[model samples]
Target: MPLTRVALLKGKSRAYRKAILDGVYKAMREAFDVPEGDLFMLIDEYKPSNFLYGETYLGIERDDDLVIIQITANNTRTTEKKKALYAKIVELLGEDPGIKPENIFINLVEVQKENWSFGNGIAQYG
Candidate 1:
């Protein structure tokens, strides 16, 4: 299971937002082996004044179009899978929303399977 959060500058069209979510879900499915229809994603749009980041960090040039994606998932994917997920996300977003590869930033929060509850007062994966 994975919970994803996407943060971006406000004022994007609804279609753009949908594309972002779809792109991420597709990437996770292909690279992370996420099950179908298991999406749990939230998108947060912030005003430029409220969102702050380095224009160029670690030699990566980021712009106002930058999207920060964070995912909390089971700590099971291999290094190759993680890298593939990142690349697939970039590719999908670039194809649809026209986001540059450099403008995409991703962070993974790994956790144990038993950490999830998924409702019913029970740990689904545990």
Candidate 2:
């Protein structure tokens, strides 16, 4: 299973958020060959005061778009997946929303199978 967490500075429209999610899911599916059922994506909206860039809070007086994406996966294929997914995210956002690549920050975390659970008391890969 692969878990993807995305955090963005507040103020984007709902359509923009949906575009981001759709782009991410498509990239994950293509890069990792992950089934839709094994993928999870979450979006976190933060207030201007909740995130900082240098001496200014994001989404306040600037157009700097701040995005942080974290991906956690169990397999070694995550390395390639991360690279492809990150690039795809940048491309999608840039083409769809006109967001620059420099404005995005993505993080990847690889974990063991024991670190995740699905439902009904069952682990993701168990």
Candidate 3:
């Protein structure tokens, strides 16, 4: 099982967000051989002022886009899958939203089965 978490700065249309998520899931499923049912995706939206680039917030008056994706997996396959997914995301967003690839950051975390719970007090896959 794998979990992908995404966080983005505000101002993007719902359609844009959907496209990115769809691309990510597709890439993950194909690259990592993850079952669709085991894929968990979460998106968090935040205001531009909430995210900083340097000494200033992302976008002041204009639209500023920043995306962060975190992937949690149990092995090396997870890492490769996340790398592919992140590349796909960057490509999609760059083509459609005109966002620079440099603005996106991706992180991968490997953890033991005991670290997560799906529901009903039951642990997920080991």
Candidate 4:
């Protein structure tokens, strides 16, 4: 399972935000083979003053539409799959919310399966 966090500057419409969440989940399912009903995600809206970023970092030329995505998941994917996941996410989001690929920033944090405890104080994947 992947716990996804999407961060963006505030004031976007509800549909836009939901589209982002949906696009991310769809990308994970397609690229990572995530099971149905395994969705877990959240969005963080930041004020413009607090959501600071380099507008032209690495010459990508990001703007106010920049989206920051971070996902924490088990370290069970190959490098190729990881690359596919990023590409798929950008493709999906670009299609839906019309987010520019250059504005999408993704970070994946991998961990051992034993690191999670879904409930009842037990590591379900341990």
What's model 4's lDDT at 80?
99
Candidate 2 lDDT tens digits, 13-112? 9988877777777777877677876657889989988876642445433344867777788756746666887888788778766667777677778887
Q: lDDT scores for all predictions?
A: 0.96, 0.74, 0.71, 0.96
Ranking by lDDT: 4, 1, 2, 3
Clashing pairs in 2: none
Which candidate model has the greater TM-score, 1 or 2? 1
- TM-score of candidate 2 versus the correct structure, residues matched by position: 0.81
Residues 66-102, model 3: lDDT tens digits: 5777878776564565677677767766776566776
Off by over 4 Å in 1: none
Against the true structure, candidate 4 reaches a TM-score of 0.98
Which whole-number lDDT from 0 to 100 does residue 20 have in model 1?
97
**Count of steric clashes across candidates, in order:** 0, 0, 0, 0
Judged by whole-model lDDT over C-alpha atoms, candidate 2 comes out at 0.74
7-89 per-residue lDDT for model 4 (tens digits): 99999999999999999999999999899989999999999999999998888999999999999999999999999999999
Specify the poorest-scoring 10-residue window by lDDT in model 1: 117-126
Deviating ranges (above 4 Å) for candidate 2 = 54-63
